[model samples]
Target: MISKVIAILLYLAVVMYLGYKGWKTTQRPTDYMLAGRRMSPWVMALSYGATFVSTSAIVGFGGAAGLFGFPLLWLTFLTIFVGVFIAMVGFGKRTRRMGLSLNSHTFPELLGRRYRSSFIQRFAGGIIFLFIPIYAAAVLIGISRILEISLGVPYEAALVFMTLLLAAYVITGGLKAVMYTDAFQALIMGMMMLMLLGGTYYMLGGVTEAHSTLASMAHLMPSKLQLGGMEGWTQGARFGTPLWLVIYTTIVYGVGIGVLAQPQLAVRFMTVHSDRELNRAVLVGGIFIPIMTGVAFTVGALSNAVFMEKFGKISIAMAAGNMDKIIPLYIEKIMPPWFAGLFLLGMFAAAMSTLSSQYHVGGTSLSRDIWENIKGREASVAASRFGVAATVLAALIWAWVLPPSVIARATAFFFGLCAASFLPAYLLGLYWKRMTKGAAVISMVGGFATSMFWLLFVHLKEAKVIGLSKALFGVDSLASLAPKGSAMWLMQWVDPNVIALPVAMLLAVGAAYATQTMQREHVELCFENIR
Candidate 1:
């Protein structure tokens, strides 16, 4: 524990100092929000990867591995193939040129200018303000969990400390700080995990023994561990997490493809001086993301070998509703105190790297996108600073109210929401000449509503406002069919993305097409920027 405390403190000092250095570079809104438009390709790629991986990849997705098994590896492929490769060659260069041409600051600004629709700016900005919290809160949840496990801190206190630390660099230096610290933080994440690879193998006897034990656990998957124990299990199996095709294409692909639409990430394009730099960054991102997320996912999943071998069962939760503790629990038990400290620092890097990006994004969405847009010009310093304060305060309030149990799904919920709401419109506006302002708005609205309805009414909602089986068909839920068989019934399954996203896309395109004839100005503006 002493070692863990020292590790975190040292890591924090280094990160905060980097933040201080970044602060020296900010003199204008562009510098604060877009790093003075002078970032190199390596910084750009690391910044993109930092926000992409985050605490979600570690605590949330890592726990998913412990829960689901090995198929989630599909994300690594989608992330690399679609996210980095396509973004650098196709989206990144185009967006950088187009954004400079339009002098756009935020994503919605670019879209609004491109499509000649003020509504797109406001609507996308609103979504950024709203759905982004779920993702940000997920980072807080992961950070809180790690802190609690390592230092015996309460989840609430851990959350406060973590969120505050994140807000420090974010509110002060904005994008410059986020990118610089992400570069540094990404490095920490890599080093710590590299160290853990050694510690993990030594503890588990070796790589061969580790795989043997995990295989044994796969065989021993208790009924509780199968596809029907949790309410989600049956649904996951019914549609198979939809990943055989949909998850990779929609949820994962949507994210990789959707990076173009991400306001915070898109802003990175505006900062780099040249397309050549963006191309250089792609190589960096390719090397980094695979190491950080790929390594964590592998170790977190394979650690189950040690888990089952030692405890006779794999338990991701050290306690009820405390999923964040899973990785920390395994690390503390499986590694020496000093190594556990390093692991904790790595975990902190994962959280901070993502949190800093979120704070930068949230503050800019509120300040630059929303506040400045309505006035028809740039915002005042007081206004930007006020936005910074409000963003931090809002995150702090959420951290205070968040319960342990709600954290995990909230993380997934946010990512899915982003994919649904922004991906279609942003991508179309970028790549499709015919993509109209009408189409952009329709897609955003459709994706947002579909994802929300699913989470509240179908997936996470306990009340079952309209029974899934009954709503889609005449059959009842699994509860109704339980007596007839083992209750892993067909109608029992519900995949929210499958149900919601497609509906939203259909709504978006249909509405846009119907309205396109009247919105030529909007369509022309989008056309001017798309290439």
Candidate 2:
């Protein structure tokens, strides 16, 4: 316990030092919000990796990997190719150049300036402010669970403690602190994941043997999963099964394409000095992203084999039917006490790094984009600081009150929502000069409405939780009446993003063509500074 306490304290000291450095260097709104738009390639890359892959990936999605198996590797592929490379090469350069041209500091500001409407800024900010806490709560729950198991801390107390710690640095240092600390956190996360991957294989004899053993246990899949379309942990769900739709559509595609639309991640593109930095970032991001996500999925699924052989039970069963608890239980029961302490710090680092960004983004969305812009007030770092405090409290309340299962679902929900709401407007704004103000507004509102409608009426989790379907329509889902067990019902398992993103794209293009376009001069000026 003493060693564990010491380890945690050491980690905190390092994070605080980074926070202090960011605080001292920050001078203007640009510095506070974007680190003066001069961050180095390594810091930006690692920071992006850390913020992108969080406890949601490690704990939430890792747990899913344990249940669903190697199929989740598809997500890692998307993270590298689409999330990192395409996002940086295809989008990052222009976003940075255009952002500077518009003098935009926040993502909402970027879209707002592009369309010349304060409403777009406030609406984008409003969406982020309203929905991001649910995702932040998910991250908080992930680390708090680990803390409960490893440090003997009560879950609620751990949640609050972690939230406050993140609040301290982010409220003080803003994005500078968030990125600096994220770089450090990313290093810890990378090392810890490597150790875990190596340790898991060692315990199971070798990598090949471990994988073979897991593959052999396909017949042992739970009855519930099998009915829901699961074939096995190793084989993944069969085609056309409910679970297959959940894994392939909801989990994979929802998060995969959604990365392109993330406000927090997109804003990081504007934080760097030049396209050269983003180019350099891709190399680091390509390697760092895989280590973070790949290792988690591999270890998570194999954990089932490790636990089954050592204790005669699968990880999910060992975790008492909660997938969220699988990773924490695996660390505690499999790894040495010292390594457990180290990994705990790693988990805290992952959660804190991501949560700090979420809180900061949410706060800035409210203060910088919505509140200040609507009221014609100047951008104030102090207003953002106060917004950070409120955002943390909101996340704490969500973490305390929500179910553990919400950790993963909340993440997907926010991702899908952001993709639906922002993807069309963002992509069109960057690449299309013809994109008009009317088109951007209609696309954003249409996408947001469709996504929320699907979630509230069609998605099982929210529908079941909100009880709107049962109360209002006398069904479990909006599709509950759609020819039971047909493809439409299978669609019920699909993420709203699948439907919502396309609607947004079509609306954006259709509306743009229908309405008068931005002036040619304006269009050329948007990219004038880039070349």
Candidate 3:
């Protein structure tokens, strides 16, 4: 306990010092919002990777891997290739150039300026301000779980403690503090993950032996999961089964595709100076992402083997069926006691790094996009700080109210929603000169509406929990009314992104063709910095 407390205090000291440094450096709104647009490539890469792979990746989705098995590794691949490589190379270059060309500070502002429509900014900002709390809650739950296991702190206390700590730095230092502290935190996280991976493999007698043992334990899969079509940790779920849809559509496809449109992530692209920085960041981000996510998923899947060997029960069974507890419980029970304190620090870093960015984006969206447009003036720095505090409070409330074992599902929900709502407009706006303001408006509103409609009315997992379909239509999902064996019935298991993203893209294209294009001069100005 003394060791844990000392480590935490020392970590907090470094973090606060960095936050103070950021505050000292910050002078203008640009400094606060974009770190004066002069961050180093290493800092940018580590900050982006740390923010992208948070407690959501390590604790929430890692826990899901405990239940779903090795197939979750596909997400690691996507996060590296699509999230890092394609995002930085394809989208990051354009976003940075265009953001500078337009002097846009926030993601919504970029969209608004790109199309010369303040309404676009306000609407996009409102969406992010309102919905991001749920995603923030997922990260909150992850670190809170870690604290509960590692420190024996009450869950409620952990939630409040983390919120206050993050608010202190993020509100004071803004993006500079977020990125500075993120780079530091990323180093801690990487070291701890390397240790975790090596220790797990060594404990299980080596990679080949561990995987072989897990594969042979297929029959030990919980009856419910087996019925849901999970074949084994190594073999993956049966094709086209209910579990298969949840794993592929929600976990893999939804999150994989969704990373392209995350507001918090997109804003980071605008933080660096040139495409050269982004080019350098690609290699750093590529390596960092795999270390964070690959280790988490591998250790999560292998935890089942470790637990079964030691405790005579599967991972979820040992955690008493709470998937969210699997990873934390594994670390607490299986790893050395000294390692637990270090792991707690690492998880704390992960949670704080992500939460700070979420709070920053949420605050900027409110102040820079919504409030500024509403008042027809620039909001004060004090106002932005107020918005950050408000975001922290909202996420804390969500963390308290959200159901247990919801971390992974909530993360995926937000990711999929962002993909559906923003990906169409954001992606096309970057390249297609012909994309009209009307098309962007239609696609953004239409995509968000469709995603929400499906979540509340069609998708069984969310609909059942949200219960709006039950309240209105007396069914858990609208698809429940269809013949059980039919295609419509299967729609219940499909993710909202599968339905909404395509709908959004189609809306964007169709509306683009139907509407008048932006004036040629404005289009040329927007594309001036592009090759």
Q: Clash number for every model?
A: 3, 0, 0
lDDT of each: 0.68, 0.91, 0.94
Among the numbered candidates, top TM-score falls to 3
Candidate 1: regions farther than 4 A off:
227-261, 317-321, 405-408, 461-493, 507-513, 517-531
Q: How does each model score on TM-score?
A: 0.87, 0.99, 0.99
Model 1 accuracy (lDDT, Cα)? 0.68
For residues 1-531, what per-residue lDDT tens digits would candidate 1 score against the true structure? 676677778888988888988888877888887788898777788878887787777776666655554555666776787667876677777787777777887777777787777887888877887667766777788877777777789978887777667777777777788888888877878787778776777777888876566665554444554534322211232244323233343334444445545666667788899888987888888888877766666676676666766775564643343555567777777777877777777778788888777777777777777888788888754566667667667766766766554444555556567667777776666766666667777787778877666554444222143355456645444333445334243222344555556776676667766765535654455446444
Q: Judged by lDDT relative to the true structure, which candidate is superior, 1 or 2?
A: 2
Shift of residue 222 alpha carbon in model 1, Å: 3.3
- Per-residue lDDT over 61-108 for candidate 2, one digit per residue giving the tens place of the 0 to 100 score: 999888999999999999999899989999899999999999899999
Q: Give per-residue CA lDDT, model 3, range 325-408, as digits (tens).
A: 999999999999999999999998999999999999999899999999999988877888888998999999999999989989
Report how far residue 268 has shifted in candidate 1, in Å: 1.8
Local lDDT at 347 for model 1: 77
- What is the TM-score (0 to 1) of candidate 1? 0.87
Q: By TM-score, is 1 or 3 better?
A: 3
Instruction: Measure candidate 1: CA RMSD.
Output: 4.4
